[model samples]
Target: MHQIEKETVLDVRGLRTEFGLAECPLVAVDDVSFQVKAGEILGLVGESGSGKSITLRSILGIVRPRGRVWGEILWKGRDLVPLDEAALRRVRGREIAMIFQEPMSSLNPLLTVGLQISENLAAHTDLNSKERKARAIELLDMVGIPAARNRLGDYPHEFSGGMRQRVMIAIALASNPQLLLADEPTTALDVTIQDQILRLIQALSRDLGMAVILVTHDMGVVAETCDRVAVMYGGRLCETGLTADVIADARHPYSLGLLRSIPRDVAPRTPLYSIPGAPPSLNALPAGCAFTARCPVAGPECRDVRPSLETTGRQRQVACHHREEALIHFSAREAAQ
Candidate 1:
């Protein structure tokens, strides 16, 4: 694997996505902001409907027509928020590519595997039919597809789930994209295949110097593969920092709850702890902290004021009124967990 140059590849600041409704707007992404440097893995984690997928959609400009967006999404120093349709199209697969969560639905069953990959190459490059075919074969091989040259005519249904996902990754990398947005990229695969795919992504990001933003709710995956981890709650970023720090010394109550709920591998019989309350609906969120309802540590102060992202003892940034001080008390126990 090649070394990545030290630099920031993508920066998102104060991003908010709101869907317009009859009398009220639904805020799907609420003032979420973060950055991904070149050649690093950043994990965006939250349960379903917590806006993890919506945040990725916001970055891709796939929000509904009635949605309102606010904030800057800078890619390679250019703000993608203001880009026109044509320009965005040109940039989509070339500079920034994405691998969908459902690999089966993502690929066209009507088109052969080679045709799909070659189409992307043909669209972006001035390559002849022969040249495009050659590039497609190479991409398939690069993505670890066995007997790659002979599979050009195979349709989506011919491949297994893992192989289809490998094809999706190959298509996303067809243009040698600088940044790859992987939304639940390995969710459908079995454990062995999941690890294999994650390893492949890690290898490729290192080899190609590509920045990766992975969306998943699995804390174990984040701990294993991410350079940094960002926890989202109620459409907002609740915490973000180096994976080791965030996993070891989480500073927010919600984050603590998430960590606790995961089954420990070493201590096989340890009971799984879960937060009691459900997550808040965006339309009817509390006036103060959105997580206050489910937080065991929430106090009168937690319900009175929303906390900004503040630096903590571990140099982690957490959004909680008491995180900077009180959360550290649980840090040692969490690390041992």
Candidate 2:
């Protein structure tokens, strides 16, 4: 049986975000583009300073005042780039919501969890205080918080890290958003808790039919949770494709490097692979492919001319001058290992 195609909930095209002086601003996100369909989970994976978080902020029009954003962020066919705060507010939290990376910082220490959830209900829905309280308890229960009504009045600090993260998820779902932007939702948690949170998010996406853009640095998480993956480096996307395809046979050197770096079930005392060199500074990005310095297969052209993202196969795109060579070269090496 053929699966039905989902609606496109978000379409981002040529997204660029910058900060600093207009004359020589530092580019944080450069010409990044992707789409999210309803009931799909897209993983945005990269190392620190790869602009994955910045890309998410740009989509929601939440970049700071000093920052500038260009290109299009179409949410349900409506352009969000040009929308003012007033207009964006109508869509934010109600139609789309975000689960920030750190629940401790994102949640208010002064306010109770129930009040925070109710605040969203008050803003987006016409529910009265009595009804909002009821909804808040229901949300807490939905997120697996035990004694939901009893926990409503508890302050954020009173909860453990995992529980606080659950509260954040509950709050984000208060408005029952169609789209959810999760920024490292499992960060700073123990492995067991991380698995639990990831499972919860997956279940919520399935049950609610909510589209998700999950930002993280873990390839393992992407492999486990995402339907599709986008790999970023130096503020630009290097690869985008279905998760299984990208993981099985990465075409870009950067993507291959990331996959290789993941630890496997190997003999004891085996040295883990690590990608060489740190990412380039945003203020001093190269004119050509940003990964050229670290890329093993880089040529003169890779150092002098930038590579545009080009289609390599069905639903797969790569920005590389030697994508075909990389595929052949890496495949042979992996097979021989």
Candidate 3:
């Protein structure tokens, strides 16, 4: 994937998001960088509170009032970090759209589904009242909502979980955005519905040639959907590579642990592997590697010095002191098991 050249849609560099007091702020995202090319799906995967969602919010300049975001968010070569609210408003939803995790909370309860989709159309497109209504129906139909014309007046609660998600996707696709940011788009849905939502997103991206950054805690979802994966831990990227390469040969210890933690069909009573210890508290993060306490191969240097993300192979980057040795150690352990 990296060998072939493609148009870069989004290039994030040294992104740091902070909240709370300025003097002693909680670093939600630290020195994170990645790129998304046209018609590509980049998975931002990690455990909860790993700054995956915050990174997306920061990129859109939608962080809470108490929070501050720094670093370059280059969308089609334009840096969005320094843009004012008015400038950002023009970029968001028009050129870049986001599908939130929970459609119920994200969608307005008082507004009808038609009106909600029309609102985005009005905001981003030049469609008039009649045109907006017709486009809304088309969008709904495109997202596979049955009886799209008749369901225009339905409220958020009137639809099932899966239908609500489709409506959200319809709203996101209202303006034909070039980039889509999806934050756990299938959260709380059943497995079957989750698959539908994931497939819909993948198909839409391919059809529209839209670059997507999908945030999720599930590595299994990444394995199935993403072309590239960036594994984050305690607000920092641990490893990034093509999904297949990372799944088969992860270089970071945390990335390896996450891959090994996925549930597999084994004999009855077989225990699933789980990462030991919890993620580090953002406010109390260590000066060295955040995973030092939980890392199986952590050495004295890992406890004292932080490792910067370094190129390990083609299209692969890892932030670990023992990148080479970690792969060997984890591979042997999995073989033994």
TM-score of each: 0.92, 0.97, 0.97
The 10-residue segment of model 3 with minimum total lDDT is: 259-268
After superposition, candidate 2 runs with Cα above 4 Å error = 328-337
Model 1 Cα lDDT, one tens digit per residue, 1-337: 9975579988999999999783788888889989999899999997877889888888878784677678999988999888777888888899889999999999998999999999899877788999989999999999899999999999999999999999999999998999999999998689999999999999999998899999998898999999999999889888999999989877788788788788766466766677687888887877678888877667797776878998765547888877645466456666767
Spell out the clash pairs found in candidate 3: none
Candidate 1 Cα deviation (angstroms), residue 291: 1.1
| Root-mean-square deviation (CA) per prediction | 2.8, 1.3, 1.7
Give lDDT tens digits, candidate 3, residues 13-92: 99999998998899999999999999999999999989999999999999956779998999999999999899999999
Ten residues in sequence with the least summed lDDT for candidate 2: 328-337
Clashing pairs in 1: none
